[model samples]
Target: MNSRDDFTEATKIKLLALAANLCSRCRVMTVGPTHSGDQRNSIGVAAHICGAASGPGSKRYDPNQTTEQRKHYDNGIWLCYSCSKLIDNEETFHDANRLKTMKANHLAYASTLVGVALMAPFEVKNEIRAGIIEATLALCGSGAGKLDLTAVLEGYEDHLKSIDPNYEVEITTTNRKVRYDITAKEGFVPSISIIPSAETRSLLFEKFENLRLTGEDIVIPSEGIDFVGIDIFQELKKTNPKSVIILKSKKHKIESELFLESDKGIFSLGSFQSLLKGGKRVQDYSGRALNGLFQYNFIVDLENEKGTMEFGSTIASWIGKKLLDIKHLPKLLKAHKFLEQTSSYKFTVECEIGNTTLKIPKGIQNQPENVLYFFRRNIKALYLLNEISKTLPIKVSIISPVTTDNSIEIADFSLLLASKPQPERLEPGTLLFNSRLDELPTPLAIDLWCQRENLYLSVTEQYNRTSDLYGNLISFPRWNFGFENFTPVLYSSIDENDRNYIFVNIYSNENTTVAFGLENGNFELL
Candidate 1:
């Protein structure tokens, strides 16, 4: 069925002119010049305000709308590729009303800009230029203010690493400032630099949060110590009357350093190894004995608004809490540990007779969800077959990629099972045939996506009838496939009346390619 009510070419051009070729949400110029004099580069989409198709995945899809209404210019809005996907992905937040309002507001703003350009006099050119400069500066500063510097740096580092796996990016905090140290492969340097435009600085800043200083005055507490003893504080003060001594303790290792405060910022003096512990015990300080084991808990700097702690002394935990801190670090630490720990569950049949289960040393537990589902469906078939004839011996085998290093992952597993089966040699990328006449045709070939996305992964090029669909013909079950360190690549185009379409090329082990199309966020046979 031709259910899509795509906008006409005229309607798309009208939308472009109406929005001044600017994305309604981002205000980015979507149409620009190309190297070819006769051609222009357009990254704009005449996005449907109410989805062209009626379905749950369709954003703001209206069932009552007629084909004419659905395809009309009034039902469309201009947007950039990223903004279009964002609105569809977050449809609840960007509802029909909200999208309409955004479009209306953008049109109004564009009209005002046009009016100003037309009416502004030459006498006020300087004033207008100054105003624009001031506005630009204000926008940049405000955009940067709303960003988390650390996150920006981390995202930038991730991007750099993705472009070149050999690239190494590290975020370091020292001298009261956070900086990024990116190292490419030996004898090579990356040409790309993270220079953000005025409009994009906000986004880039957010993504590269790991690059910037947190401006957090974090203090790693001395395990059980409370307040700094007045005697020890005075002793350290007497040694360096103009500087504060900071002892950074981590994993029972402490480094004593002197920090001199100045108008510009705090300066770190050379470290003094064993300056406090040299020839002295904890009880020799003429203060309460320190007994607990010390470990690093948080980051701190001498540039803290409050005065730095004295060396050979302890700062109260309360004082540390009052200082600036990055509270999410501990949560991030916990999350890292959570990801490291893996677990899984297995399903088995417990009949009045003996329990039927696989006897592999490595049980089905701890396998991927998709693998588990495949085993469950296989078990169901086996259970039914066993009901018919309990005397028949059933043999099951899981085939996986044969690697010389025995490092095949569980996700690569494929099932092979039969009752009273004849032994046959199974080769990689070869079809297995069913010897029994009663058995249905098994799926000889299968192609799985590492990561599934909307409007992608069409197994076949064309299906003549509804029953001819691969899903209906094949007995094989669907599993969401995944792999470690793999990222799916997507291709998109603004073709056919500026309609945005995302395409996926599905490749099987046989080297056959099948293409799929996405229209209005729904998959379509192409």
Candidate 2:
């Protein structure tokens, strides 16, 4: 009864190509060259949107589906191994309808490569052109040799002319040396010249024995650009502000800078020159930066592989009316010598290994008096770190010190734990418990502080000063809370009782206030 219906080989191939060999969910490239550099490696899986079997217990099972329909191309979505298993286990979140939407979104993103960058500058377009040249060079193997250009021109002529009407190809030879040049009439297409290696020339000579290299230019009547190279990174030069460019080149190396042109002016996203220095190719990379706001610095030196990423930022917030709730408010307000600026906070984050450094914009103001609100605003940095840890070993360090300055130091302590923690199990009735902390293998010997009036929470991984790497990259566990930040409105005075209690008002469909008393480093529901 549980007989599985599987996709055809053709369908599987189409699924991978349509998604551009990227997982629909995480958008990580699934196909790449293996370590041997000769064979290809594919981590892609043609996942079933609906259950493959007609069994009642099968996830997202549709009993009405026929065997052919169950195995049809439309029923499949390409995903990585981890994402495929994740969707199956989390059936509710990854329903068939949601998976279909994800498939459509991925296809749409892939289509943008051709649709958007069609008008990019000719010189910039040649980056893609260079990839094809490299691929063709590989076809001929190693060594400098002559290659026939007739078939290659005939195949791509029509497509090239689509981008520029004057597109033409010319192949000539002088003294046994071949010169292959692609040119356009005037501004239509810029002249392109690339000397094929000896091996490429040999293979081309064999492929087209009748073809001869002459001293005069041999022009081919073709007008087009090679769109085949757009799939190199599945992205184009003029990407949207929120777009992320992962280094998934067939060559696995970047030799130029990535930039963006906007109405304001041209701005540099970052450079990839250092990524390919020392003859190393980027083997694996994952992160999200270049989001139109921050300056990016990425270094993917796999050979040396030893470095640290440090990100520092200053935080400032206006001291609002809530200051009246503090115990020393009356005295502080009377002696308010520093009326210009209310508060300033500073902190730094250090990681052992990262592809890039993420900058947090300085002087964030008018923030809600919620401890979690700060984390929410900078969650992207955490996500970037998490993604990098998937392919590289990393350790996190957070440092914030309290000095005898007028500004209040919100950062008094740091929590060092795994970047990726186990599913946090909440102790019963704990209103505010560090869910991820309970799964620690050993008891953490660190100071813990919690204040209600001026909320501050600093959570970081444990700092053991050891070489051992901790944490596996996994999806953060869902929190049982609403999007609106929760704020503690009322608190029992510490002078009144040994056990201090606070009531937090959480916003949701209906406003609800929950009471909690501090106990054993956790806030228990009172």
Candidate 3:
């Protein structure tokens, strides 16, 4: 085991700096308010993608590892505090389904941060620009999908170091200011000059300028070789006030190649005609109104919002025709209660399972109540079985509801056949009661049950309960529920002649299981 003492102070500082940069980038990526609804403080923490517990085993910290072996940037990702803590605990971090969700969240946050950084003022002083660039480079590295000003600074530093044996460099920066210092050999008069590269000068003037600076203060020394300090400072201030001057003649080679490698396309358009006539059509013609008839070709009658009935149709005629063919449509039959209540409709559904009831609002017509019903039923049944598994001598597993289509079932329970306790797994089972299988009961119920009994309940996935058009129902066991797995439960409904759907699923380790199917709603234990 590598102890913390093995990490030098310099290495620790670098790690912390990298962490800070990553955290800032994550915050910028998740631009909207978090679950807490606060926008100002949204930065996430930089977590070791390989888990912090890896220590010396970590690719980032392995001293003996070659640079090429540790080069991939995907090894790290930004995570919120809650997710980070889960990773640090090493409990159960890498679930394929859960990982997909987390990766999407991370990508969204990263993209937002990159955009904000690109638009942010560069802080014209050479030192500040260098510091910012360094920080960005540390977070994203050279292959970052966006522009990195830090790589440019690194090339410049490498060039300067080659020119003098005793050269020293320092960088300072704030939101408003930046400065760079370069010192030549000791015992010799230090050669100090502003960064002389044209690219560097342009970036400073174009991106940094007044956007980042607060005051128009600049200084230059006179009587030096080439451009004197006073003369350079005065000229820079007039042309680009607030610019900071630094040593110029150092062998700092700002590589144009590095500057051009940003993911953000930087090529100029030249002119509109050049772009339009050169390649494929530069504009979209689809969905364009030809003669401005009805606003656009895709326009619908305003009075018939659902577009189920043609414009200028009587409500009575629409209802009469809809009711005549109700048997052919299962979704319409399910929604008959709302359809009969009032012609002016408010999309909503209310369902009851024993004493436990739920009310879902409008706009979720795509999600069918039948699906939710099965989810809630399965969840309740699983909790009940979990309670029984603790005190009972026989191990039990329950299949619960997996889909709104009534084709899948999921179950949860633990069995101990011999003296030793067996690991929990999901299998097909009969439905004890008619209810939704995907929905789990309240957390309080599970906690109370666990404290009272030594039983562990693991509910399986929601599965298809009904056969398709054929009499045979498909049994896909791997789709069974397990802890930490994230699966989507889909439901379908129709409103106002338009069909809608809803997809939902819970993410939990202890209260999940795979979905299965059985004959006549009964399972044969395997």
Candidate 4:
């Protein structure tokens, strides 16, 4: 049946961020403010501009309306808890015409403030540009603000040693400034100089006035802490950054192909020379338009002045967002809301189950037996995540030891089967069957992302029309094996999206009915 009551991932995110997650009716959140960062601070609900249901509560549900007209961005409003609740008290108050007017007016007010955000002073714009870089680093799932300079440097040095112990990269930090001392012979000195204070950073910029260096000479303008990445043996083609390997901190291991993921306005080796260069006036922004600001920055800012009228740390928040302070990172629906810790790379998530909320930590979900439990508890969130996954892939694997040894990682599936667990493979009531094959479908082991030719795993779902509890016909029961590092590489939309699959029922026995696809391998097809 056709329905107009659904919101796409993109539309929902737009309504929340643009509304600054504020309530529309009262212009005040009765439960709490957006500052607290708690999902509990979720007093602002994205109400349908027209009613979404045809039942008792719906005031303007149109059964004949087309999908586009019903779910359009204009068909939504951000309202606070009190207003959202009261609108239904008197059905006529929230009539379609009245609600539409409120949305239009609220957005117009938000637009004026964004005009200033876009045309912020030169100093402030620089801060925003810097924020983009810092945000990318934070995407590595680590506490990036208070960086471990020594650890980052050492990781780079170790990578260099692997190239050749004789090849050297030395790192030293003094007075909050960091310098990479790469002792090269025969006059070709590799240098990575991190300038701290504005005076020195400017002085260094002056030196680059007429000089342009190769990608080897990366002059990263200091945002704070030194960034040396998976730099060794990377594609020196320089134009396209493949992946980076930064050294790990003595205490924390930094692992991810973060900088490699290609996306729009996401990653760039942006120049900071604009700050150093003279003669550029803050253009005439007298028009004072929000759309102009949005188009200019290519970023969505959901801040409003009303929310700031009642704040003690607005200055601090501004500084952090402007500068690349870890504390005041950009809050978008795209980013993960993991738990905080004093010092750790991974983050825990707080999710409610039934009436009780539980903290789902990283280490806990990675366990084989606990995988089902995690999926069962967070089914709704995971479903939303899967929907959102169309835009951004959700990487749950840990790139640790099980994947470090490349030779072992690419081994045939049959060879690695002995090391895997062989217990109650199927849930108690799971249906099982066995069918003989003409030939053993070559015991192949592919990466998590391999060029495969299948979708909708051919087993349980095809027969019973029932995917596992998580709705995933194929999944990695455990992420810390050869399969952890694999990702399905799909070149075109037409190609199959499945990867890292292993056929399980073929290997199941009466005693060990592993119908759950419990057996783990790099192949995604089960």
* lDDT values for all models: 0.41, 0.41, 0.33, 0.37
The per-residue C-alpha lDDT of model 4 at residue 170 equals: 70
lDDT of 4 by residue, 1-526 (tens): 8443777778877887776555666665324445656555556677786777677767678778777867788888877767877886766767888988888787777666664543326777677556544443342224423565554555444545565444466756666444444444445545544433555466446534423221112243333223233243221212113222232111111111111011222321111110011112211101101111101101111232111100000111222121122231232113312211111122122323246542322123232323322222232233322332332234321112111122222221222242344423433333333232212234322321343433122232222111221222333223221111111322223335423333332222233332123233332322
Off by over 4 Å in 4: 1-4, 29-40, 115-526
Q: After superposition, how far is residue 56 of candidate 4 from its true place, in Å?
A: 3.0
- The window of 10 residues in a row where model 2 has the poorest summed lDDT is 407-416
Evaluation by lDDT, superior candidate among 2 and 4: 2
> For model 3, how does the per-residue alpha-carbon lDDT over 1-526 read when each residue is reduced to its tens digit?
6432233344434433443344322333322355777655544553443333335433224454344323333334555666556554553545433544665564555555543634333443656656654554443333233443344555444533554546565434444233446565557674435453554566445433422222222333222212433232333233334344543322211111000001332221111110001111111101111011001011212233321111110112112222223122332232332233433322222223246432222122333344334323332332323333344444443222222223322223211111123334433232212222223465623443234333233454344322211121222222222232322333334664334433233332333343332222232222
162-187 per-residue lDDT for model 2 (tens digits): 44455454434455343434443555
Q: Model 2, 27: alpha-carbon shift in Å?
A: 3.0
Worst 10 residues of 1 by lDDT: 283-292
Off by over 4 Å in 2: 32-40, 64-69, 114-327, 332-526
Name the lDDT value of residue 320 in candidate 4.
Answer: 16
Worst 10 residues of 3 by lDDT: 269-278
TM-scores for candidates 1 onward, in order? 0.25, 0.25, 0.16, 0.21
